[model samples]
Target: MIKDYVSDITFQNLSHKHMSFERVFRNIEQFMEKDPTGNFKLMFGTDSQVFSRETRFITGIVIQQERKGVWACFRKVTIPRRMTNLYERISYETTLTEEVVALFTDEKKDSLIDIVLPNIYKGASLSIEGHIDIGSGKRNKTSIFVKEMMSRINTIGLKPKIKPDSFVASSYANRFTK
Candidate 1:
């Protein structure tokens, strides 16, 4: 299920509509290069929507600086069958997000880090995170899987964020899941 969506996925943002992951990586580098002293955050997340005959899962990758603009893109995965199970859908979403997060290897991350390292004394910083749509709230159905999902992200060494704070998944990615 994972490979089906990731292997040949195309990422797109507002300016570009058809881009490979490699291109997206370069865009990230370029965005950082433009303002190396700004505090930057790189985030990955996934959200899904089930239709009558299929389910559409969208994963988004975003980089931004608070009060500044953001560079973002998403890839969609469609499953022929409907996924009625809440837990299964949520789990797969997490898996999808994790797989994308893994694409940024230590060296790749360090390259981005290196951009800001020189200006750290001036408050330049970078933080990478995995965003989960689940939130621990009375009305949030995904609250049940918070622990498991967060642990999954933690296992991969990426900081995890949930709803309200997890705009990448619940907001950005969700926008395209429809």
Candidate 2:
């Protein structure tokens, strides 16, 4: 059953008895990895404005309950200054598109309700804030800066941290690839 969820969606199946959160992350990482333009602006750009605008950042947030769990790993990929506004716009657009897709797909629609909806509130929303650095200077310091920024944003009464164990791809997701 969990394998079904892993399909198309990047995830790893750790165990049959338990769901593996790592799979979700692996998939998310893979998705972002496939993107060639992650921090290109950060590297070879001449303009400061251009540098700041095009750095990639990623972070994971979660909500946990005794009987339920919700996790979302977000990749805040920076685009060029020209594309910043469009990127933010698409950031919002992607969620809407997912909702529409879920709405149309019968099985997904039901799963969203039966599985995803119950764990998440009707209007639950989480806006994670993280920093994007162009160069690799002071990795520890940079990481702390991003984490601190993200912590300030309230996750709408959701749990602060939830980590998954392992990852295995779902059969459904595998079908599309190999």
Candidate 3:
């Protein structure tokens, strides 16, 4: 039933149906601006699922400031045909994460960091993390591809997380893939 490839660069915001990257970026900006004193983690990750004759991928962009609040949104990309290769799918997922991360240029990241720097002594901070859906457990089918995928994420300077700790990818993004 899958038609063809579709790419949606706009993000799905909690308060709105679709937003351009700029709006989504500002949304988080306003979110953090509301409480710059809370700890923050800006996370990005991607996950995929195979439908009847195609594959659908969803990438989540999340910002969590604990007690302050958490903001999340996702973008979807689809391929016309089902992709059964574990390695291929995982690679594509990581690629999607990288692409999204690139959108938040160094200048943009520094701006976000600027918001939390003054409170560093007070425990306020920010970290950018990339989550890959692959795992390292022996029985995990995606285990074999962990190194390659993590390396890809690492090349872009994102602290990579996997399996149990990679909820952004395995959980958040996975929810939208369905």
Model 2 root-mean-square deviation: 15.9
Clashes of each: 0, 10, 0
By lDDT, the better pick of 1 and 3 is 1
TM-score of each: 0.93, 0.24, 0.92
Kindly list the per-residue Cα lDDT of model 2 for residues 1-178, writing each as its tens digit. Answer: 6456534232222222232334443433343233322211100001111244453322222222222333233222234444344334323322322321232244522432333333344432222212122122364433333343224212222112211110101111112222
Q: Write the per-residue lDDT of candidate 1 for residues 96-136, one digit (tens) a residue.
A: 89878877879889899999999999889999899999999
Instruction: Write out the backbone clash pairs for model 3.
Output: none
Task: Estimate the lDDT of model 2.
Answer: 0.26
Q: lDDT by residue for model 3 over 43-160, one digit each (tens)? A: 9999999999999999999999977668999988899999998888888999899989988889999989999988889888898899999889999999989898888888898899
Clashing pairs in 1: none
Model 3 CA deviation exceeding 4 Å by range? 1-8
In candidate 2, stretches whose alpha carbon ends up further than 4 angstroms from where it belongs are 1-70, 82-106, 115-178
Q: Return the lDDT, model 3, position 25.
A: 89
The reply for model 1, stretches above 4 Å from the true place, is 1-7
